[model samples]
Target: MALRMADTPTPVRHHRRSRRSRRAVLATLASVVTALVAALLAWPGAEPADAAPSTFAHPGVTVSRGQLDFTREKVNAGAQPWKGAHDQMMGSKYASLSRTPKPRAVVECGSYSDPNYGCTDEREDAIAAYTTALAWYITRDDRYAKKSIELMDAWSGTIKDHTNSNAPLQTGWAGSSWPRAAEIIKHTYTGTWGNSGRFATMLRNVYLPEIINGSNSNGNWELSMMEAAIGISVFIEDKGSYDKAMAKFRTRTAAYVYLASDGELPKTVPSQNLDTRAKIVKYWQGQGTFTTGLTQETCRDFTHTGYGLSAISHVAETSRIQGEDLYKTDVGERLRQGLGFQARYELGEAPPGSLCGGSVHRGLGPVTEVGYNALHSRLGHAMSNTQKLTEKNRPAGSNNLFVAWETLTHADNPS
Candidate 1:
């Protein structure tokens, strides 16, 4: 019968038609499958039209639940470096039980040259709050948790505005720690924080608006502010704010960290109006020699450069926790190069005469922990200079401006 059908002209034509129909069906299926995969890759965890997860997903933000648990386990097992760093944090004044939070109606901090009265108190209290939170997390002590809540509530309830010229920087400094403390206390602590809502409101109303717009001042100013904005956005579960902060962070990071591929000059923020080469050179502190790892604030000093680098790492880490891996992107490369370049100099490499007039101002601070953990341990990147410097500076502590207890949180953290 098959031979008879094959020999039939009509049947042969029918068979050919069937084959074409099958091919068309298969091709359509393949197109659909390809489209779905493309969509998934383009926007992970969100529909093509929908925004990403909004609201503070517990164990989200800069530190994830897995990471916190890992830290706790290491600390409990009395792991070498973790134990030492834990002792360092718990022994500091920031963790003292007798610490009192001094809340002000208005905090007015001038630049370094002209400081204000409550500037130190505000910054220290914020640090102390974070310290107590770490203590609570490690020890399961109710007292420490309560103390952390008290500090947050004190500032949230009393502080209405940050005034004067140093307002943004002050807010950035305190704002950065508040969310880290809040995330730990709100998610991990079993104790009831009645004013936690007020704290959220404070962040959303007072801090978020101030920093979300991004700054055009020195690169450090905007970087630190965006760092605060990004952390607060995660805590509040505001995906829109998070996106804005991340975009600005990318721009500022590129401008701050120079790469050889960027031609003879470092990149500048387009909005900053550094259109002319001369203008860009001026903004870069007149340092014309552009190379990998050179920062916009390098000529200013390493201290400011450290601020920029720390903020970039913090934002990038937070983004990674949110399921968006910035480390695999250009942002990550910039951060890695920036950290390596700074670490090399910090490790006692004298500057060449072609760069910064043959001398570099060194004060990169304790800012290498998160970046080191991400690049070295997780990704298996060879960062010898950063690794050596990080090991040499184990139990990295706070810089007193914003960065604090990074070694305790991020040192060799696989999670």
Candidate 2:
């Protein structure tokens, strides 16, 4: 029973009109935004960020708890390669009980380790920590665990920063291993690590800042840095660093390894600003011809190339443990081709004069196991050249940087 006006009020009609106009404007704005997003996505050299996991997995940097369990089970059974690999590691100086931690206040290095101050000690200590961590798991000896903790604690307490030209790369190399040892001891060891929090702080303050920024010196540098970043992120449970590092890893992985599908000139990291053909060629170590599996440093040397490849595998393995399974993505494809290409030449296949001017370096080192195990054993990919090279270097030992005892941890490991 409301009184009806002869005509609608002027303000009410105006309000209705304004609402309709606002909705129309909103609709138009949404359409424009959608079109812009589509354009951005389709732009050339657009590197989209990969998705991050809702929750991270523990003891999952390059190696997992399941992998540890499986490897230990095999070792106990006196398995052929596993037993041999374990024996080799147990016999090494790294697994020795008398090992001492050589932490540095400020590690410094120049090009090609010219300065080499605290470089060797830092790398060796990190490797020793990881080696002992593995030994502790397989042998069930409390001494190994305590020694690992001791090594980590020494570095964590003393390492304040890394300095000089190779600081970032050096930090990256050592950073990659610290988390591996930290992850195992933090999660698996029955005894307590009193200074575990301090170790995490050292990684965050000293190591993470140096490597997480993604270097442009060389693909290997950034690759190794990202390896450290990813592993450290998992150990400290920092999701943001993990995502940032993962994005860089994906970008660097693509740019580091060349594929025929990536077009005439290899994919370039945008920040590197590799605009012209000449500049790109120089950055690629003067290799003009492009082919599948050729790395940015393939012409520079196989040793550096192996570092990039190893970092790729380590990041991919860690990502897999976190539940993303990057191996099923383009990461796996690039790794497969990269490994095979290097392996083919590494296995004594002569490169034509066109390839690296016919003089390719040998010695790929203990870098193939992690990648091989994931692609071949886990994914059932047929990689003959990689397979041969990997088998020839069974029980792959440390590269004296970050890669250590992968043959013991990952040989035919199905977990």
Per-candidate TM-scores read 0.86, 0.92
**Model 2 C-alpha lDDT per residue in residues 1-415, reported as the tens digit of each score:** 2322233335665897767766776787777778877775554433345445677788989999999999899999999788988998888888889987777898998987879889999999999999999989988999999999999999999988899999999999999999999999999999999999999999999999999998999899999999999899898888889888987888788899988988999988878899999999999999999999999999999999999999999999999999888889878999999999999999988999989999998988899999999999999999999999999988787778888888888989899
- Model 1 superposed RMSD (Cα): 10.1
* Per-candidate clashes, comma-separated: 1, 0
Give the distance in Å from residue 135's predicted Cα in candidate 2 to where it truly belongs: 0.6
The sequence of per-residue lDDT tens digits that candidate 1 reaches over residues 1-415 is 0111232234465887877766776787777788877864443112232223544466565677788788889999999799899999998999899888899988888888265857888888888888898899889999999999999999999988888787888888888888989998999999799998999999999888878888889999999998898889888888788777766777778788898877777777768888788998889888888889888988889889999988888887887887767788777888899989888888899989878898888988999999999988999999999999899988899998788888988998988
- Alpha-carbon RMSD of each model: 10.1, 6.3
- Give Cα-based local distance difference scores for all models: 0.84, 0.89
Candidate 1, position 56, lDDT: 46
- Report the lDDT of model 1 for residue 34: 82
lDDT assessment of candidate 2: 0.89
